[model samples]
Target: MHGSPTGGMPNQGAATHGLAALLLLADSRLPAGGHAHSGGAEEACRAGLITGADDLSRFLRGRLATAGRVAAALAWSACSASASWELLDAEADARIASPAQRQASRTQGRLLVRTARRIWPSATLNDLAKALPEGSHHPIALGVAAQAAGCTPDQAAMAAAYTSVTGAATAAVRLLGLDPVTVHRVLAELPYDSVIAEQHDWSALPAHAAPALDLLAEQHLRTEVRLFVS
Candidate 1:
């Protein structure tokens, strides 16, 4: 029999391990309380901003370019940073203009942290929980979780970018009953590469504003009846 790279054992590359971690972190099935929030899709749907697949596509594209880019940069920064959780949380606060959006981010962050700590059990995640008793931003928690799972900064960024719009896309399917295949096609076309760029400076993370989304979030908070949390 032919011997493998490591003395007859199958070789497992770091990329393969990272890919698994990335998929788990990005999966909607994770008990991270992500199912409750729509990433502003509920509001957008009620506001008639996303009436169909084409409108949803445009909305998701815009979100991917703006909020998704910011989230990817923040997650990459957090994954790369060893002890800058507090600073990163503050930076997230500054970048999120809407109070409603900020609340949603922190809510998701706290839930993600709770789930990640139980699953990964890393000192980094512990420090993150300690640093922000209130809760770190969602992207920050995601980055730390990725690190604990043996994922690289790039994988963290990709996961962050992926989630930024996926929740909303799923929400749209529920809200408007749009074709799942068509919605997924839109998701497949997202320019993830453009959002998941390398960022060396944590302080200079992308702050692409989504005023419409922000307004939608604020409006959603005020609505008496809603299907999703945000």
Candidate 2:
């Protein structure tokens, strides 16, 4: 549903402009608690799996390949605006392995939903309120929020991909003590093509393949000196 970032064509309807949707997706104070979790990016940094400017591309590419599945699912679902939250939540929950990570997503998701309901009141957002549990997962909340904001699944997917990559890079710098410039450079190089998403379906994806991020995520959870939540 997202339109051109620079607004729509001359005399085109405002709905075609994606500036508002982009702001909503990019806003950091949306109460999603995204600032907390690193999506295992921190653990990778500590394990020496990621390093200076040379490693940025590979690191982000790997991360996107893994975590991008969840993002694709939620974003595609968002376009419908009438998706089943419970089903989608369960689908996303199945993707989650560690108990700590599952809880973290739920905590953030619920908080994000609450924030959305308050800041930008709407029927679709309220519908989500009545549909989901008190504590849904992050992707589930994001799906509903994206729908309410009039963003299509592809647009949602791009936002999700970018967000995951950014969250991990942020965590890497803090946890592994990596240089900020290097982190930003790698972040910038990460491929974020929305065109490759296709039809977004991971129902048959093997857990170990599309989501190897759990290895670092679980490891990070066991560490006593970690900075990020997960």
Candidate 3:
């Protein structure tokens, strides 16, 4: 029995490996559908709100601290809970400002799931897929999926923070006519953890979700033509 594989003690070594795996999956460039969404920076560019990499970084970080942080918090909440996907989804919808913006979220969620499934095979992910009703929002999906991936709340928040920054920077290149490398470097200066850590507390997230960033998303949505999701 000394070397037998079957045991109920819970494998610490395997658990460590799992956490490491989660870290990789949570990486921003895991080929997820993030490339399809600009997290509202597209609208900022079209509105001339951000004219350069410096402006893009400021806009991106601002959005991240507000709306992006909220979404990340919801995701973390769902992950830390008993699979309350619907509750989180509703929260995301309620926080969003416009129809088109909401539509973009739902679209991106489905796309992200498709990408996550191929990259990180998980029964929880499959279960969530079956559990989702039509038009589940992206942030909700991200929260549930991050749970399935065994990612920590902090890790999920960082992923989201980086996603917002990268999305805006990428969109700035396309819209404001900036250099992608310069954009990347500009965004790199962002202290995402310091920003995202505001949601590190489980109890404080809901209060933090409503903010000027949400107002910005709402205003951007009213524009006729746009280049990204808010």
- The TM-score leader among the candidates is 1
Residue 118, model 3: lDDT of 67
TM-score of each: 0.94, 0.80, 0.76
Better of 2 and 3 by lDDT: 2
- Candidate 1: C-alpha RMSD to true structure equals 4.7
Runs of candidate 3 with Cα error greater than 4 angstroms are 1-28, 197-204, 207-230
Task: Please estimate how well model 2 matches the true structure, expressed as its whole-model Cα lDDT.
Answer: 0.66
- What digit string (tens of lDDT, one per residue) describes model 2 on residues 1-230? 33223344463444554446746775655556788877776777778777654665677777676666556555556545464667766777787777777877788778878886675556666766777757677766676666666566666667776776777777767765778887787777667783226444546432324445666767788898887788
List runs of model 2 lying over 4 Å from the truth: 1-13, 176-179, 194-211
What TM-score does candidate 1 reach? 0.94
Query: Which regions in candidate 1 have their CA more than 4 angstroms from the true location?
Result: 1-13
Better of 2 and 3 by TM-score: 2
Best by lDDT: 1
lDDT of all the models against the reference? 0.89, 0.66, 0.63
- For residue 215, what is the lDDT in candidate 3? 49
The per-prediction tally of clashing pairs is 0, 1, 0
| Model 1 CA lDDT for position 139 | 96
